[model samples]
Target chain A: MAKSFRDSLEAGFTITAEIPPPKSVSFPKSIEVAKKVAGKVAGLNVTDNQRGMMRMSSMAFSHILLGVGCDPVWQICCRDRNRLALQSDLLGASALGIKNVCVMTGDYPTLGDNPGAKAVYDLDAVQLMKLTDGFSNGKDIRGGVMKNHPDFFVGGVVNPFYEPIELELLKLQKKVNAGAKFFQTQPFFDIESVDTFLEQAKPSGAKMLIGVTPIKSMKMLKFLNENVLTKPIPDGVSKRIEFASDQMMEGLKISAEFINGIRDRVDGAHIMPINQVASLPLLLDMVEEGNGA
Target chain B: MVYNAPAMIITKKKDFEEILFAIGDTRSLFLLGCGDCATLCKTGGEPELKEMSQKLVAKGIAVTGTAVVPAACHELDTKRVLRKHKDEVDKAQAVLALICGAGVQSVGDNTDKPAYSGCDSLFIGNSKRQLHYYEKCSACGECVLNDTAGLCPETRCPKSLLNGPCGGAVGGKCEVNSENLCVWIDIYNRLKKAGKLENLLLKISAPKDNSGLAKPQKLELKREPGR
Candidate 1:
C-alpha cells in the first residue's frame, strides 16, 4: 500500500528540507542538492521561482526529485498564476504522484531578481486553501463551475512570532476552513513566542509541524532576531549554541534538542538549514535517540 | 511590470478634512476624475474619486451624480459626467478635472464655466523615488523597443537615432546620457546579435493619441469567468 501522510509522520520525527530552484534551466545545482537528501530525510520541498526569480519551473524539478527516490513537496504560490493555473497545477501534481504541497502568498517581485516582472496574485494562501477544497467538493471558488478535481494534502505556513498573534490565528482558522491538512511554520528559535502561537493556532485541528532551525553563535542569533521576522533566539537556546566548542555540531544539537522538547506539542519538525540540509539525517537521529528536549 | 512601488493618492484624514474646510460653502460643483486612464494611472480610481465627490457635499457641493465611464477624453464619458451634473455644473462656478484633458474639455465643451485640473497631468513616466519624479516614455512618434531590444530609442538613446549606432553607447555607456543605456546602439547590437537585422529594417508603428492629441483611445478587457 502507498504510505499515507499520517503514517509518514508516524515513522518517527518528520524532517523536511527546502531546496530552492535554480535561476535558470541551465543551472543544475538545485537538482544536485535535491538528490542529496533523498532517503535520508522524510521529504524534500521544491520552491517555485522562490522570491520571484525565474527558474526552471517547480513542477518539472519536483518530478526530477521524485525520480531520484525523494518525496518532493511542491510549493504552489499565487504570485505568478491565477485560479485556473493554480487549480490546474494542483490537479496535475496529483496525477504525477506528488502528494504534499506548501501554500505561500509569496514575496513581492519588487523584492526579487526581476522587480520589473508583473506579479499575478490570483488568490492569497488562505483563499487558495479554500479554493482547492471547494474544487475537491466539485465546486468552484465563485460556485459557478464544476469539474474533475484531485485530493490534495495541502499545507499552510505561519509565523508564530508575528505581532498580534490573535489576528494570525483568525487567518489560520480561515486556512483550515480552506482544507489545510498540515501546517509547517516559520522558524521557532524562541519557544516562548512559538508557544503563544501554538495556543492560538492549536484550535485549527491541523496536523501541526513546528519549524526548529538551530543557531550557530550569539552573532547568528542576534542577526536572525533583528533582521528576520518573528524569529528571536531565546536566551536558553542561544546559550546552548554560545558555549559549544564546535559551532556547527552545537547548532545541530540545539536544534535537535529543541524539537525533542516540544515533540509532544506539535506533530512534526521541519529542519530548515540555511546551508546544512545534509545535517538533517543526523539531526533526526539525535531527536529520536536523545533524552533531552 | 509589477506596480509594487507604492504611491500616496490618499490624503490623510487631516489633510482631506482641511480640503473640505478650504472649499467651505462651495456648491453645485462638477468634480470628475477620469474613469479609464486615471483609473489605470492610480491617481483617481472610481472608488476614491467617488468618495472625494461625496465628501465635497459638506461644503454645500453635492456630487450626487458620478459616472465611472471610459476615457474621460472620450465625448461619451465626458458628456455623461457633464450632462449628469450639467444643472449642478452649470449652476456651479467651476468644473473639476477628475480626469485628464479629454475629460476637462468634455465638461468645458458645453459650458462657459471654469474648469480646474485637480490632479496634475504627469506625462506617462515612472517615479524615481518616493515623491521624486522623472519622465520615461515620451510617446515620441515611434516605439523602437522591437529593434532596440525592448529599449526605446527616443527616450533612452542619446540622439534618438533610429538607424545608426550612436557613439554614446561606448562600453554600454550613453555619451550625452548619464547612466541609462544608449537606445540606438542597444538596437543595433541587439538586432545584429539576434540575427534579426531585418526586424530593425521593418518600420515601427508611429506613436498615436499621445500628447492627448486627437481623441482618446478606448481599451476594454473582458474576463468571462470559469473560462
Candidate 2:
C-alpha cells in the first residue's frame, strides 16, 4: 500500500523528484522519467509550466502519474490563471483524487515562449494557500459555503539563499499560517547557508525539503550562477566542477555530498535535476551509497 | 529642493503605418490635439499636430485644418471647440485625434465624422522628467498602499506579489526587469524606516477584491435633492 504524501511527511523523512511535463500532449519523455523514479522517490512533482514555457497542465499530467501508481505533487502557478479558473481547477483536481498541491507565483510570461500573453496573478502565493485552506474548511475564498471541499496537502517554495533572510522568513511563516504543510527550497549548494536558514525556519513548523540541483554541465552552472542565483556561487564548489574531467558526474557527486551532509538536519531533500531527468535515480543511489559509507 | 514631474494620463503614439492603415481611403483629415494630458505626453500637443499635418500632406492627403483644444476629453468643451471650427470639421472626411482613447472617443461623440486614435492609451502615470514616465497606480480599485508604506506593489512589482519579494529580487533589483529595483524590497526598506515592518511580517494581504472591475465601472455622485 502506498503511504499518502502527507503521511510520508509526517512519519519521517521523504525524497521528492520534479518532472517537467513535456509541451506536447503525448509525453513519452515525462512518462519515462516518472517510471525511472516511481517508487524510488516518495513523491513526483509535475511542474506547472516551469519558467512560464507552456506545457501540459500540471493537473492533467498529475492524473497520468497517479494512473501509473506514483504519488503526484501538482504544482499550480498564479501567473497564467485567474482566481475563478484557479478555484475551478482546484475543485477538479480534488474530484480526480489528486491530493498534493504546490502553489507558486509563476515566472512572468515575458520570460517564456509567449511574451505577449497576459499575466493573471489574481492571487499571490500566500493568498492561494489561504484559498486552499478555505477548501479544507468547506468554503471558498469569498466565504461562500462549498458543497464539497478538498483535503489538500498544500506545499510551497522558499529560497533559503534569498538575501535579507528576514523577508524570506516572514513569507515562510505566512505560508505556514496559510496552511502550507511542507515547503521546498530553491536549489542551494552550501550547507552553512542551509544551516542558517533552518535555524530561522524551524519554528515555522512546516516540514522543510532542502533543494539540490545536480549541475549537468559547465553551461548550466554558468547560467544558474550568472542569472538565477542572488549570491555568487561559492568559489570552491565552482572550481571543483570547473576542473573535473567529468563535469556531469562531478555535479552529481556535489549533490550527493550536500544531500548526505544535510540529511539529519532537514526534513528531507528535493532533487531538482532540471531537465536532466535520467540522472535522478543515479543521484539517489549516490546518496544511498554515501549513507552506507 | 526637488523637481517633480507633472502627473498626467500617459499615451504612446501608434506606429505611423498603423495609423495610416486605420485611416485608409480618407483623403482629408482634421488633426485634433489635447492641451492637457496629451500635451504633457507630447502625443497630441500643437507641435505634434503640426508634424502630423505635414506627414499626411507628404502622403498626398489633404490637411483640412488643426486645433489644440484645451481638453479633448472634456465632451462639452470639445463640442464647443469643434463648433468654432465647423467649416474645417465639415470639409474633412474624418478626424485624427492624437490623444488618449478617451479624447478620441470624445471627438467621435462630438462630431458626426469618423474619428481615429493616433495614440495608444498607456497608463495614468507621472513623469520623472521630460519624456520619462513611470506608472504610479494600476487602479486595481482596492488600495494596499497603507499596509505597504505607500509603495504600490500592484503597479510596481512585476509579479504584483502582495506578500513579499518572490525570491527573484537580487541586489535590490527585480528579476523580470533588472533595470528597476524590486518594489517589495523598496517597501521593506520604507516600512523598516517607518518602524512598521510588522505590516508585512505579520499581515498577509488577502486576494484583491476585483468585483469593482467586473464591468465598465461607473460612479455617480449623489445630487443634493433640491439644488
Candidate 3:
C-alpha cells in the first residue's frame, strides 16, 4: 500500500525536486546533481520529453536515480504512445522497479523542434489513470491476468489560480475518482485562489502539493504572468516584482518573501527551476526561512 | 525472354502494424529484412528498421532483434544471420519476415520460430516495370512496332485488325470507350506527323495465329542460377 501524506511526511517539511534528463548519452553530471538534490528533497521528479526535446528515456533515468538511493517519480505522458503501447510500457516500468508515476497529457510535439512527427495519443490523463487502476489491485491491465505489479503512488496535476475554478475542481474530482492519490498543482500566486482550491480539494483524500516555478527576471515574471497557466499577477504582487526595489538582489529577496507568504496551506512544494537545477539549494533555503517564521 | 501480364502490389505501414498486433506479447518478435526486394523498395531498409525499433522501445516493448541478410530466402544467408542474432532472436517469442513468400519459407525451414510475412505478396510470376502491361502476346512479337509506328496493333489495338481509321478512333482518342487513346489512332497521328501514314494500311493480317490469344502459356526459366 502507498503511504498516506501525513505518514509520508515524517519531517515537518517535505521537499521534492525536479531533474531534467541529460542532453547526451552519458549522464554523469545529471546523476551527480540528482544525488545532491536527493539529500535535500524527498524525491526527484524525472521529466519525460520536457519541452519536447528528445532526451535519454525517462525510465532509464529513473533507474539511475533509484540506483543512487534517490526516490524517482517517473513522469508519464499520453503524447506519443497509443493504448497498447502505453499499457505495455506501464507493465515494463513496474518490472524495471519504478514505483511512482505522474500522469499528464504532454505538450503537442510541434511546440518542439520536431514538427513532422505524429503524436500517438492513445489515451488522455484520466483514461490512463483508469488503465493503471489494475496495477493498484495486483491485476494486469487486462483485469483478468495477474502479473507482478508496481506499488504505484499515482498523482495528477491541477492549476488552482487557473480561471473557472469550478471546472478545474470538477476535473480534479474526476482525477481523484480515477484514483489519483495526490495532486501537484500550478503555483500559488494569489493566497485567495490557493485557499479556494484547498477548500474545494479538502474532501478528496488526495494530498495536494503546490507547484512553484520561481520567477527570477522581469522577463520570466512576464512569462509566468502571461504564459504560465491563467495565473493573474495580482496588482500588489506585480508592483513588488516590477519595483519591489531598484536592486535586483533586493527584488529577488522580496519575491522569495512573497512565495513564503503562502507556505502554510500546502502539504509540500514541487519547485520547477526550468534550467536552474543548480540553484535549488538557495530556493530551498528561502523556503526553510519562510517556513521557520 | 519476355514478360506478359506481370502484376505486383505494395502494402502500407498500417498493414505492418496490423500483422504485429495479431502476434501480441505472448510471442517474441524477430524481424528479418531481405537484402534484395525489401531493400530495393526501402520498406525494410535499415533506417525504417531502426525507426520501428525506436517506436517499440518508446513503448517499452522487448523485441528479439532485427537482422538483414544477403537474401532472406537464401538458406545460407538466413542461417548465418539467425545464428549471429540467435540469442536475441530466441528471446523473441515470434519471428517476422519482411520478404516475399519464398524468403519467408526459407527462414522458417531452418529455425523453429514461426516466420510471418512483413510485406504482402501479389504476383503470379510476370513482374515487370513495363510502361503498360500486356494481357497476352502472340509472340509474333515480330517487327510489328516498326510498321505500326510504335503502337502495337496486335495487342494494344482492341480491334486486333491490321487496318487504319477503324471508325473507333474519335477525337484522336479511343472509341473502345477507353480512357486511353486507341493504339491505331496514335499510330495514325504519329505516322501522319512523320509522313508515314501509308504504312498502317499495308493490309497485313497474315492468318493471325491467335489460338494463343488472350490466354496463358506456361514455361519455366532459370529464375535463379540454380533454380
Candidate 4:
C-alpha cells in the first residue's frame, strides 16, 4: 500500500508540491509534470479553479495524477458549492479512491474572469473541515449514518504572516477543533514570524507544511509582495532577487535556504510554483540536497 | 458599555400616500415613536411624530394621541407607555408606529388596535451625521469579524463574500458601488496595519451559519432561583 501523506509527515520531513489545473481541457502537460515529480514528492496537491478562474476541476485532475502513479491531494474550495454539492463531490472523490483532501474557502468569484458569476460559499473552511471529518467517520453532515464512509486525510491552510497573530492562532485552534488533521501555510518570507507562529501553534497537534513559492522573475516577486501575499517580502530577499542576473536561480536558492532553516520546526514544505511547473523538479532537488534527503 | 445591544436604524419614511392607503378608512389614529433607534434615525422621534399628527389632521383624520417610548421595541416599556395612554389607544381606530419592524410588532402585540409601520427598517448600523447611515452587520448568526480584522463581509461586500476582494473591486472600491471601499481590501489593509495580514491568507472561513438567523429568533437566559 502507498504511504499516505500524513504517514510520511509523521515518519520524517515530507514534501508536497502544488500543480494548478490548466484553464484548458487538455491535461497531457499537467499529467507529464505530475509524472516527473511523482516519486520525488510525497503528495501532489491539485488546485481548484485557483483565483476563481475556471479550470479543469481539481477532482478530475487529481484522478489523472493518480493514473500517473502519484498520490494527489484533492483541493475542494467552498466558493463554488453548497452543502449538497460539496457532500456529493466528497463521496464521488472517495469512490474514485482519492484519499488525501484539502479544504479551503476559495477566492471570491468576482476575482475571476467570470466576474458576474454568483459565488456559492455555502460553507467556510472550518465548517467544510468538520463536514469532511464527518464523512470520514461514516456520517453525513446532517449526522446520518453512511454505509460507506470516505477515509480521507483532510488538511487545511494557515497564514503565519497574518497580523494580530493571537487572533490567527485562535482561528487555527478552531480549525483544529473542527478536525483539520494537517495544515499548509501561506508562503513565508521572514523566518522570525514562522518561529513565533510555530511556538504558539505546536500544541494544537496538527501536522504543518510551510508554504514556499519560488520567484520566477523580479516582476513576479514585486507583484506578489505588493498584491498577492499579505506578508511583505523581507527587504533583504527582495534586494537579492532584484539584483540577481538569474532571478529564478536566486529565488530557488532563497526557497531552499528557507526550507532548510525551518525543516526541523515543520513536518514538511508545500512548494507552489503556480504556473511554472517545469521548475518544480529543480527546486525539489535543491531542497533534497539542503535537507540531506 | 455594560450592555451593548443591537439597534435598528430606519432610513426611509413611508410616503404619505402609502400611509394613508394603509390606514384605509380608519378616521382616528394613535401615533407611537421609538426614542432610541427611530429618534436617532429621524423617523419616529417626538418631532416627527408631531409632524405626522399634523399631516394626518390636514387630511381630515383625527389624531387621538401621540407618545414616544424609550424604546418602541422594548415590550415591557411599550406596554407601560400604552397603559398610560390606554384611553387614547382604546379610542383610536388604528395605531401608526413610526419605529422599526420590531417596534411595530411590539405595538401590535401590546395593543388591541391594528398597528401599522410608518418607516422601513434598513439595517443594524450607525451614523456620524443626520440622514447618513452605514450598514455594519447582516446578523449572519456566524460572525467572522475576528478573522477579517473586525470588518464584516456579509454586509459590507456587495456579494456578502467571506473570502474576497472579489475581482470587481478596483482602486480599493467595490465593483457594485465605486463610492464604497471594497470590504475585503479594507479588511486586508486593516489586517496589514495590525500586523495580522497572514490571518486573511491562512484562514479560509466557511460559509456563514444562516440557520441561527431564522426569523422570529428568541433568546432566554438562565437565571438563579433567588436572583
Model number with the top lDDT: 2
**Regarding TM-score, does 3 or 4 come out ahead?**
4
Greater-TM-score candidate between 1 and 3: 1
Off-target runs (Cα >4 Å) in candidate 1 are A1-6, A10-13, A26-36, A140-148, A217-219, A288-293, B1-227
User: Mind giving the per-residue lDDT tens digits that candidate 2 earns over A1-293?
Assistant: 27767788888778888888878878776687677777777888889988889888899999999888789999999998999999999999989989999998989899899899999998999999989988988887779998769989899999877767787788888888898989998888888988988889988998999888988788988999888776666887889899999999999999988888887788888988987887887888888789422
Judge the docking of candidate 3 as incorrect, acceptable, medium or high.
incorrect
lDDT of 1 by residue, A1-293 (tens): 23444457756556676776665666465555555556556777788787567787788777777887788878888678876788888778878888777887676576568878666654556667767666666776567667666666678777565433433454566567667877778788756665777777878887777877767666777887765544446677677777779877888887877777776666777767765655666676677687375
For model 2, the superposed segments whose C-alpha errors exceed 4 Å read: A144-147, A291-293, B1-7, B223-227
Give the number of colliding residue pairs in candidate 1.
9
After TM-score superposition, the amount by which residue A116's alpha carbon in candidate 4 deviates from its true location, in angstroms, is 2.1
Question: Which of 1 and 2 is the better model by DockQ?
Answer: 2
Order of quality (DockQ): 2, 4, 1, 3
The digit string of per-residue lDDT tens for model 3 on A1-293 reads 22323245544345577888887888787777776666666777888886567877888888888888778778887767777788777877878877778887665566566756676544666767766766767766457755566567788777665333433454566667767776777666566777777888887766777666655657767777665545466666666667755434433354356457655666776777665676666666666677424
What's the ranking of the predictions by TM-score, best on top?
2, 4, 1, 3
Q: What TM-score number comes out for model 1? A: 0.57
- What C-alpha lDDT does candidate 3 achieve relative to the native structure? 0.64
Tens-digit lDDT string for candidate 4 (B67-162):
998987789999999999999998999999999988999999998899999998888876656556778887777778878888888888765766
State the DockQ of every prediction.
0.02, 0.73, 0.01, 0.12
Candidate 4 TM-score, true structure as reference: 0.64
